[model samples]
Target: MLTSLYVRHFAVVEEAEIGFGPGMTVVSGETGAGKSLLVDALLLLSGARADSGMVRAGCERAELAAEFDLSALPEAREWLRQEALDEDETCRLRRVIRSEGSSRAWINGRPASLAQLGELAGRLIEIHGQHEHQALLSRSHQLALLDAYAGHAELVQRVRRLAQEGRALETQIRALQGEEDHASHLALRRHELTELERWALAPDALAELEARQRRLANAGRLAEGIAHLGELLDGEGELALRRTLARAQGELTRLVALDARLEPWRELIDGAAIAVDEAADALRRYLDEVDLDPARLAEAEEHLARLHELARRHRRPVDELGERANELRTELEALEQALAGLDARLAERDRLRRDYALAAAELGASRRAAAARLAADVSALMAELGMPGGRFEVMLETHGEDTSLDLLGRERCEFLVSANPGQPPRPLRKVASGGELARISLAIEVATLGKDSVGTMVFDEVDSGIGGAVAEVVGQKLRALGSRRQVLCVTHLPQVAAQGHTHLKVSKENVGGQTRTVITRLDEAGRAEELARMLGGLEITAETRAHARQMLERAQAD
Candidate 1:
């Protein structure tokens, strides 16, 4: 339920904050008083398009905000939770349009895109008018409404799932016959798998083999390096650390006998000499093992080349050759198995097709039954809403020749209508006048009460061409609808305004040479005065006031 609306600098309305309660709220005023501005403000808050034209004159931007109580709207609450926009049990929608034609929106005080705002607003409100967002203008919405009436949700879901599965199977069958069935492709795949199997590659085999190859390639360089290291450590060279360290240790030992303070220096030189000898011995052993073998080097090079060629052929790096081989092997095995079970796969596909056909048939049957009821109910309501002898039909056209799968069942739906007797029903969109469309839309909405999940419904002058007794009937229907869900009606008929649980009168006033719109909520006495004005027009008489009072009393009694 929408709880409040605040509008600032919107069109001719400078500022207005209107509070609404649940049930029927009637907005009425004289012609050209901007009664529809309230509805427009709600639409903007519901994510309708905004432009500089909506901004008030002398104002930089127009701001509109609405608050909805979600306590009774579990679906809305859950939606907020899913979108991470929940603010307790309330939902706030705000929109701003600048004079430069820039527009922005926010949901729950968090910046939101137009799409998000529209999505949330769709679930929150449904506006019926000559505009595009009206659900009655959409054939898909008609079909959905009929399906909801028939409780076909589960059946429809099953059919949709079956159709999706059929599409996936069709794709797989095409691949099997088109791409994977080629003899040349299969032969190449087989050869690759055989080569990989023969090599039996391991994850780290390439790295290990390459390291061994490097060692064999540089065997001579390694031997020379080892020999030079040994010469530097102990050979008969001036830089031989072992020979020099031995001479230094002998001199230090003689000095220590002369001066006991040099004993520590002698010990340090002896340790250095021993360490050099040990290093030279280790180097000699390493040189002995550095033997060059061309056979081994060639073998490592050939193995590394084989790995590289396979990697390039498979469009992978040498390090990932093992993983690629495993993947190819798995795919080849699966393809071979699939070929063996080709007949079985075909049989399974046939079974799935049969299942899908069965589900679609069930769904179609339910829809046809529901369509009958919907047509009957809407036609009956149309007669009461001033469309006497009007006929409404829910036409279901089946696609019997369609062989391909579709998620929306195997039929199309159209809402056909005829406003006069002896005329065949035509598509609802073909109806010429806006008045007839509004009435038809009203009948459908009234008949489908509790079928829609939207919390609020707005009717923009739907009673335009209606008055007298028919206007009274329209008011009763709206009141009944309001009893079920929140309803806001912009009406000029006194009868409709009298039926509202709450009434607001829109009036235009000039202030400082500027025309501005204002909305005033009417109390009991105020309601009677407004109703009198509506009934008597520009003149208010004592008799008109008495009649207005009687009308309100009678309406309340009902």
Candidate 2:
């Protein structure tokens, strides 16, 4: 239930705080008194779009806040707790709109996104706008209303889940078959896989083969270079580097015995001779191992060339050939598996379709039963709400009976209404007048009241174009609804105003130099006067006051 609303610098209202109670609260005001502005502020707190124009002319921003008691709204409280926005047992929704058209929202004083505010608002309040009859005309909302009234929410959810599961399976099977349908495309991949398999490729094998080929190709030149190097270093030749270094070292050692500086030169000559001898030994071993075999070299070259050709054919680098081979093999294995399982997948799809069909049939039957009960119940309430000869019906249109699967089952639900005895039932939108539409909407809501999670219901001018005894009945119905849940109705009818447990009057006046709208809760005497004003128009005569007091007495007696 809404506890209070605080508004500041919004539209024509400078500042006002209105308090509300549990049962029916009716807001009534003269024309052009900005009563709708209060509704607009509530809408903003409920995540409606903010308009810069709503800000007062002298103010930079407009601020609106609403407090709701969550004791009876467990779902809303749970939402607040989950979002970490709870504040004891109350939920505070605040919205601020800047003159520049930007806006911000807060839930229980915690910053919130507009979507979060919207979600919480939806769970907490159900606003039946003056134009809400348009929603009654919507097929989806009509179906929802019937389902809600018949307690078919759980069953509908089950059917939706089954349908979703079936669709997922069908999509998977289609994707696999889509791949299988391109058999010709898979043919090239098959050839690539076969070529890679024929070589038995490994990542390092190609490089190793290339290295061997290089060694074989240069074998003769390598042997000659090593022999010549050996001769220069230590072989029996006049220019032997090791022999010359040894003689130099012996002379330097003898000189070092005479002078210390000669010792450093002796060390240098000795190191040079040692390095030359090591090189000559290594060269001799290499010369002995070197082999010039044309046949082995040709075979290595041919193997490397074949690997390179495969790389080119696959448009891959030579080193990546082995990796490419593995990828091709994996893909080909998957395709083979898919082909093998095609028949099994088809069988499974058929099974899933059958499952879906069974669930949908059950759901349809439940809806049919629920629809009948819903039409009967709403039609029964219609007469009391001011539509005496009205009839309500639920028309179900079925589709996809011959197809494989469907999402919202096979039926489409629409609401049909006959407002007069001689006329046939037509779509609700086409047959009901504005006043009749509001009454029908009221009946439907009353039928499905407790089934809805929303704790607070707002009716904006629902009594429009209605008066006299019908208005009194509307007031009674609203008061009854309010007994179970919070109801806020905006009306100009004194009958409805007289029924409120709490009455608020909206009025406009010139304050200081500015025109401002103000709302005040009225006492019993004040309520009588307000109702008298509503009844007598321009002047409240003694008889009008007496009638207003008697009306209140009669309403209380009922």
Counted clashes in each candidate structure: 0, 0
* Local lDDT at 270 for model 2: 83
Q: Work out the TM-score per prediction.
A: 0.85, 0.70
lDDT of 2 by residue, 97-158 (tens): 99999999999888999899888987787777555424467787677666677676777777
Name the best candidate (by TM-score): 1
Shift of residue 20 alpha carbon in model 1, Å: 3.5
Off by over 4 Å in 2: 1-8, 14-23, 42-50, 61-98, 102-124, 132-135, 176-359, 418-426, 429-436, 501-505, 509-512, 519-533, 536-558
Q: What is the C-alpha lDDT profile of model 1 across 133-166, one tens digit per residue?
A: 6766778767777777787789989988988988
Worst 10 residues of 1 by lDDT: 198-207
**Model 1: residues >4 Å from true position, as ranges?**
57-61, 69-90, 108-111, 168-208, 254-266, 321-345, 388-390, 400-402, 420-426, 430-432, 509-516
